[model samples]
Target: MSFIGIDLGTSSLKAILVDGQQRVVADTARALTVHRPQPLWSEQEPGDWVAAALGALHDLRDAAPSAFRLCRGIGLSGQMHGAVLLDEADRPLRPCILWNDGRASAECAALEAAEPASRAITGNIAMPGFTAPKLLWVRRHEPALFRRIRKVLLPKAYLHLVLTGEAIEEMSDASGTLWLDVGSRDWSQRMLAATGLDRSQMPALVEGSQPAGRMRADLARELGFDSPPLFAGGAGDNAAGAVGLGAVAAGASFLSLGTSGVLWRTTAGFEPRADRAVHAFCHALPGLWHQMSVHLSAAASLNWWANVTGHTEAELLAALGETVTAPSPVLFTPYLSGERTPHNDPQMRGGFARLGHETGRNAMTQAVLEGVAFAFRDGKAALESAGGPIMEAVVIGGGARSGLWLSILASVLDMRLHRYPQTETGAAFGAARLARLACTGENSGEICTQPLGSPEIFNPQRDLVAAYRERYDDWQSAAEFSRALQ
Candidate 1:
């Protein structure tokens, strides 16, 4: 038997086919773009996601035709907090408002004022990045569009509708909407009311491992599958990545340096530390919760720097070798797309400080690498200060491919980092694992083991750790000045 996993990322749509042995048979991706019609605003046409997923599935089917025919189940994982409003006919009302968009800053405050217990109910701060704030923004700025809304869905839920003709959302993704009573693992009527919504507008919620819906027979045949596949309730990107890394049990943890950076730790129950800007939400698994301190830019910073310098990410890293001898001469703020976690200020922008005449491309590149590491250090401190101490965490994502960046991040956070062979496809792998559990009814704990390999460990060096600490302190002061500019 085989299963499929789809990860709808900010930059692309990825699909992976895995056999019963948990081996990846074939994986493919289709590029996606984010549109910014105005500053601090980001949107995407929902139709693009469907087109990309269809195209990617066909590519995967062509790569492994036999395995594709035996597909037993499918799972989904996606970027969280994207607001996809639907009309009465189940069509998108407008372009979906994305998680990174900061245009809802005023609405975020208004939301909190409208519902004073928002932090307690949702276990999250009223940040512009969350789903409820975006809806509020639409209500005030696009009142006519708001009037036609019949249902609301996160990005993956919208995909679910296309795949199964069912309106469903899983817990981990719903937790980011600010309409869920995360402690209860269900929608909160009072929370929904604050945004001029009700439970009827929300999708049916399920745990990530459960079967939410089955594939439509007509669509299944059209896509070349001999039989319809079951659809598992998948997870938000970070939670799914954690499941992929076997970080489901309490205290198990990992850090993801994807387009965005996330410091994720699984917890035993609802633990709200919203005051620290730490995200407390449900884990992909039942009865488990997680806390994440996120930075909006991580690998994205390197991508930005690479684009500016006319070099591939690999080329830039090859120039730096495996480690740097000292702290960067310059400090970079890494807020190219604004800031989240601890600051929660969407208006804040990033830049470099203390550049010298001697600074060259190498020094600037090193600074960019160090800047993301410093931001991770900030998030680590926030999570640690809230009683979750930093020890070691498995690291995944495209950024984990950079040995030099890993070395810097290890020393900056003074924590051990582990990487497995399956780092790059962790989210999709986790989603595939969920499909397996749903199809076979296996124990998730047993099914979600570390991928087959001895992990490459990145340990902190005493000298480098001390050096990074001093530089990180200075960077903190500089970050405040940047935040003040907002």
Candidate 2:
């Protein structure tokens, strides 16, 4: 049998087809764009996600028809914290409020004020990026629309609804909404009340490795599947990426360089450090939890620079050669969309300092890479303070393709980074593994084992590490600039 995994990402929908042995048969992706209707507000039409996801699957089917026909299971993973409100007719009331949207800051504070034990309940601080706060923002500003809401689904859960005709959510993704008792791996009643929502609006919850529902018969027929595919309760993008990297055991970790930068570490138990802005959420698997230090921008910063400079990310990165001889002459802080992790200040914008006349494209590009690496250093320290240090990390995401970025990351954070094949599609691959687990009831450890081949490892260089030690200090000072940018 073959399994399919789909990851609904902010900028794309990625899918992979794998055989029973878990070897990738085919992979495809469809580009997606985020719409910014107003400053600090990011939104996407709900219909676009369904279209892109189906399109990606169609691409996979066309690429390998024989392999696609044998598909028995599917797993879903997606960007977390999106608020998708559905009307009574099961249609989206408006465009989804995206994970990176910061327009709900005031609502974040208000939610905290209303629920004093919110941190204790959700194991997370009330952030504007969370779903509950977005609802609060809508309730206050768009009361008429809020009143018509019939269901609240995360992006992946909305997809689950469309595929199965049932609204179901899994633990890992639900934890990000500030509506789950992360320690218990279930929805928290108090949190729902605080957000002016109730159980009826929430979807049924499941573990990420369990079956949520089967694909609708029509969807199955449309995709050429002989039977309705079992939909695994996949995961949030970060958790699915962890599963893909085999970062399920305690202290296992990965640093993701996607649209947002994330430092993820699995914990043996629930560990909450909301005081430090460290995210403590449930793992996709039961009896496990994870912590993350997230920055709103990582690869997105490079993408932005590439867009403004009229160069593809590949071309811009190629100009820098294999590695930098020294830290960039100028310093940059990768806080383009404000920041998270150690600094909860969403108003702390990023910028460059100490640029000289010699600062050209290569120099600026090196700084951008180093700056993101330095930001990871901040995340490293925060996670350590919350628990212990993450000695090494599997580097995954689009940025993992860049040898220079990995070199700089290793030197800046002084941790080894492992780069495996298919580094960019780790989440979708992991979702496939989850589908396998859900269908065959296999031992997770065996199913989610680390890649077999010897991975190319990026180790820290003595001289570069020393140089970065000082540069990181300089980066920190600049990162603390102000809230005035808001």
Candidate 3:
């Protein structure tokens, strides 16, 4: 048997076909566009995701027809905290307000003012990126549209609705909505009410490993499937990526250096630490939870630097290799997109400090790399301060491909970092695994605990640890000054 996993990412939609042996048979990705009509605002039409997903699946079917024919289940994973509002006819009310959008900052403050217990119940500070704040923003600014809303869904759950005709959400994605009672693994009526919503407007909740619904008969037929595939309630991207890395058990953790950086640790039970800005949310699996320290920018910082320097990422990295161990006199703060973990400041901006005539291209590049690593270090410290300990971390994402960056991250965080062969297929692979569990009736622990291939380990350099610590201090001071300016 075979299963398909679809990842609805910010910039693209990726589909992976995995056989029973857990081997990837065919993978396809389709690029997506994000619209920013105003500063600090990000929006995307939900229909574009549906189109990209369909095109990706079509490509997958062409690449591996046999596996496609044998597909027994479909699983989904996607970006979290996006608000996709729908009218009574199931038509989208407007463009989805994305997770990185900072336009809801005022609404976030209003939420906190109206519901003081929000942080205690949601286990998170009110941030513009979360779903609840976006809803409140709509209620205030788009009152007519808000009144027309009858249902709400996260990005992937919206896709699920398009696929199965059911508006259902899984735990991990719902937890970010601020409407979930994370400790109880269900929707919080009080929290929903604070945002002028009710349970009826929310999608039905399910665990990520369970079946949300089966594939629509018409869609299955149109896609040339021999049988309808079971649709699993897949996870938010981070949680799904964790399952992909086999980090389901307590104390298992990984660091993701995607557009946003995240340091995630799994736990056996709910543990809320909102004081430190550590995100406490349910895992994809039932009765399991995880803590995440999120930085709004990671690989994105490198991308921006490359763009401004008029060099490709490859060119920049090649230059970085020559000055890998050189300490940069310049310090960079990577809050170009604002920050999340350790400081919930939406007005924060990033820049380089202490630049001089002697500073070369390599130093500036190194500074950017070091800046991102230091941000991860800040996240690590926040996670630890919030009572989540870490002995090691599995590092995955676009940035993990760079040996220099990984080395710098290891030294800066002072933790051993492991890299898996399947790092590139992170969240989609995990969703495929969840599909397998749903289709075969296997226990989540059994299916998700299988070892990832032998990992390459990056150990902290003994000599550079102290130097990186000093650099981190400088970075922290720079971050503080930037926030103060805001």
Candidate 4:
């Protein structure tokens, strides 16, 4: 049998077909738009996700008809922490408040004020990106709409509802909402009440590898499936990617350089260090938890630089030429969308420092790349400070495609980095693995722990590491100076 995995990302919907042998048969993605009605606000129509998802599935079906027809289960992964409020009829009440939206800062403070034990309970600092604060934002600003909210769902859970007619959520995604009790792995009544919500408005929780429900008969028919496909609860993108990369075991970790940068490490038990702003949450699997340190921009800083410089990413990366003779004098702080790890400051902005007559496009580009690497180092340091070890990390995401960036990251982090054969397919492939586990009742460890195809390892250069250590110190000083100006 074949399994289908769907990743509902912030900028696109990606679907992949994987057979029982764990080989990807076909994959497709459809672009999605984020609606920004106001500054620091990010929203998306839930209906657009559903449409994009279906469209991507259609593309997959066309590409691999037999594999698509043989699909027995479906799993979902998505951007976490989005608040998708629903009415009594299960229709979305408004555009979802995305994980990156910063409109709920005041609400975050209010939540902490109302629930003093919130950090202990949720294993996280109250951030505007979390669902609880977004709900509080609605309750305070759009009280009428808040009154109409009958249920709350994350982005992927909304798709689950659309496909299965079930209001269900999985642990990994729900953990980011500040509603789930991270230690207990269930929704917290106290946290919900603090946000002016209750159990009734929450979706029934399930493990990511468990079956939430079967696909709706109509959806099955529309998609040309022979029978109703089993739906696995799946996970948030990072957790799902972890499963895909076989990072479920304790100390197993990976670095993702997508729009945001994340350094994630799996652990055997609940570990919360809210003081560091390090995220402590349940993993997709039962009895497993993970800690993540996040930087708001990684590859995004590169993308922005490319856009502003009128150069393609390829052109800019090509300029690196495989060796680092010296560090760029120009230091950059990559706080383009504010920051999370260590400093949880949403008002922070990023820019280049120490430009001179000698500074050119190449120097500026190198600074941008090195700056992102430095920010990720800060995340790694925070994770380590929180007692999470960093033996090694599997690298994945769009930025992982750049060898120069990976070299810089490895050197700056001063840790070995491994690249899987299919780095870009991490989350979707993981969703597929979850589908297999849910459908076949197979052991999650066995199903999820396939060797990444002869992984390529990136080891740090000692000289470069030493140089980056000094550069990192300077970068921290530059960051402090920037914050002082704010």
Candidate 5:
């Protein structure tokens, strides 16, 4: 039987169709707009997510109707930290306040100061992206709307509600909301009191693979299939994406270079970073915890370069490929959307240093690649500080498609880089596997038995690693210098 996984991302929505043996049959995606109505605001129409998913499903059906018809289950993985409020009829109250939105700065700060109480309950320090801060922002500035909140769901859970008519969150997504008791995998009464949020407004919590509910027969037939069981409690995108990368064990790790970037390491137990720079979320794999260091601009910087140069995504990588040189002296700080991990400052900006007349777009492109890697190292330091061992990082994302970018990231990270055949489809593929287990009652880990295609490994060159060390030190100093600008 076929199973499908849908990834509700910030910039786009993607779907992956995979069969029993774990081979991806078809993958589809659709782009959506990110609205910025005011400064420091990022919003997206929650309906756009459903529209994108349906559009991709239509495309998938057209591509492989028979396989789509045979699909037995559907799972969702979505961008975490987005607050999507629903009115009494289960309609969105307003556009979702995305993870990148910085309007909750004050709330985050106050919560951070109360870390002892906050962490004692929520299991992590407050950040601007967590749901409670955004809810507080609404309560203070948009009280009328906050008063109308009948339900609050993360990005993917919102989509799941639309698809299955059941609105509930899984532990993985719940962990990101700062309302979940991470240690016990339940809602925190302390957090509810602090945020003044009615715990009833939240959905019934379930584990990631737990059955949310079956798909509506009418909706399923309308879309092209018999009603299949739908798993509600899917996962936060990063955690689900880690499942896609097979980073299930404590030592397994992966570097995802999507529109944004992340360095994720898996552990069988929760190890919250001491500084809380790295996010500590429940893994899609039950009984495991995942720590992630996310960068706001990974390939987004390269994408901007591609736009300016009028090069297609393929051409941009091609140009970087032909002009292979030892890592360029130019440095890039990919803070286009401000940074998340290591440096939690949202006021930071992106830049290129040591740009001489000879420094062409290729060098600039390489800088963007290496610069993201440098930023990732900051999170690496945080995770290491928490006593997690750094191992070779499996690389996944659109940026990983760039051979030069992958090699440079490996060198800068001073680790081996392993690329999967379906890099871009990691989340969907992982979601598919999860869905299959939920549907067929199959062993989930069996999906990992087959190694992901022929992975190209990039080992760091000693001299380049030494040079990157010096460059990294300078990068950190530059970030400190820029902090005063805020």
Candidate 6:
């Protein structure tokens, strides 16, 4: 039997066909647009996600009819931390506030300042991207909309409602909402009270791989399926990506470089840090916990540089090759969208310090790559301090495509970076693996035989490692200085 996996992303929806053996037979994708009406505000229509998702699946049906026929279940993986509010009739009240939207910063600040109520209930201090802060923003600014809210769903849960006629969130997605007790895997009553939202407003929580329900007969037939089993609680993209990297087990770490960069580590027990630099969330894999430190700009910063410099990534890479020989003693902070880990400051700006006349474009590029690497290393150190010893990290995502960046990461972290066996579509393929596990209770076997590629290991040059160590110390000091100024 084959399982259908749908990956709902920020800019697109991707659908893949995978057999019970966990091999992808065919894959297709469709794009969706996000609108930014004002500065620091981003929104996406929920209908666009559904439309794109359906179109992608329809394309999949045309390309792989036999695989479609053999499909036994449909699983969903999507963007996390988005706030999608629906009216009494399940109609979207407005475009969703995306995970990257920072309009809720003031609200998050106020919530964080509450001290007693904030830490006691949410198990976290509020951050701009969290759903609760977004809700509060709407309440303060658009009271009418807040009053109309009957359901609060994340992006994936919105799609699940369309497919299965149920409004619910999986443990993985719910963990991002601040309303959840991450340790207990349930809604926090204290948090709900603090947010002035009722328990009824929240979706019922379920395990990640459990059957949500069968696809509604009409919707199933429209998409060329005969009531496919819809796996309700597939997981957020991060959780799915973790599964893709096989970080489901203990002591495993996965470094993701998408539009944003993330460092994910898995542990056996509930481990919440008081610093609130990294977010601790429920893992897709059963009985596991994940802590992630996010850099708002990872590959995005590279893309920005490429666009501004009018060069392709390959061209930028060639330039870097010319510059790595003479490492510039300059620090570049990768804060294109502010920062998340170690310093959750939105006002912190990206810059190069102590630049000399010798700093060419290539040196600047090298600084950007090294800066991101250093940022990740900071997170790794914090995780080690909180959770203890994390050495091996499987590298995956668009950034993993660059050998130079991988080497930089390995050298900066002073740890081996295992290249993903399958990288680009790790999240979708991981969702397929989850479906397989849900269908048949087996952990070891081929999930996808078509390996993306083997990782090219980079041993840190002793000189570069020592240079980075000193640079990292300065970077932390600089960040602290920036925070004090703010």
Model 2 local distance difference test score: 0.91
Worst 10 residues of 5 by lDDT: 442-451
Clashing pairs in 2: none
Candidate 5 residue spans exceeding 4 A from truth: 113-116, 274-276, 308-310
For all candidates, what are the clash counts?
0, 0, 0, 0, 0, 1
User: Please, what is the TM-score per model?
Assistant: 0.99, 0.99, 0.98, 0.98, 0.95, 0.92
Off by more than 4 A, model 3: none
Indicate the residue-level lDDT of 267 in model 6.
77
Model 3, 1-486: lDDT tens digits are 999999998878988999888889999889898899998999999999999988998999999999998899999999999999999999999999999999999998899888889988888888999999999999989999999999999999999999989998999999999999999888998998999999999999999999889989999999989998999999999999998888888889999988889999998988888878889999998889999999988998998898899999889999766335645899999998789988888889999999998989888889999998998888888899877468799987778888788888888888999988868678999999999988888977777863457888899887788889877787889989989988
Q: Please give the CA lDDT of all the candidate structures.
A: 0.92, 0.91, 0.90, 0.91, 0.79, 0.78
lDDT of 4 by residue, 71-132 (tens): 99999999999999999999999999998888898889999999999999999999988999
Q: How large is the C-alpha RMSD of every model relative to the true structure?
A: 0.9, 1.0, 1.2, 1.1, 1.8, 2.6
Model 3, global lDDT: 0.90
The list of candidate 4 runs beyond 4 A from truth reads none
> What lDDT tens digits, residue by residue, belong to model 6 across residues 75-156?
7899888999999999999999988788888888766664356654445557787898898899999999999999999999
- Superposition-based RMSD of candidate 4 using all C-alpha atoms, in angstroms: 1.1
In lDDT terms, how accurate is model 5? 0.79
* Candidate 1 lDDT (Cα, 0 to 1): 0.92
Q: 1-486 in candidate 2: lDDT tens per residue?
A: 999999999999999999988788999988888999888889998899999989988998998998898788999999999999999989999999999998899999999899999999998888889999999999999999999999999999998899899999999999999999999888999999999999999999999999888999998899887789899999999999999989999999999999999999999999999988999999999899999999999999999889989999999999988978899888888877778888887667778888887779888888899888888888888899988777898989999999889999998999999999888889998999999999999899989988656789999998999999988888777776644545
Better of 5 and 6 by lDDT: 5
Minimal lDDT window, size 10, model 2: 477-486
lDDT accuracy of residue 33 in candidate 4: 90
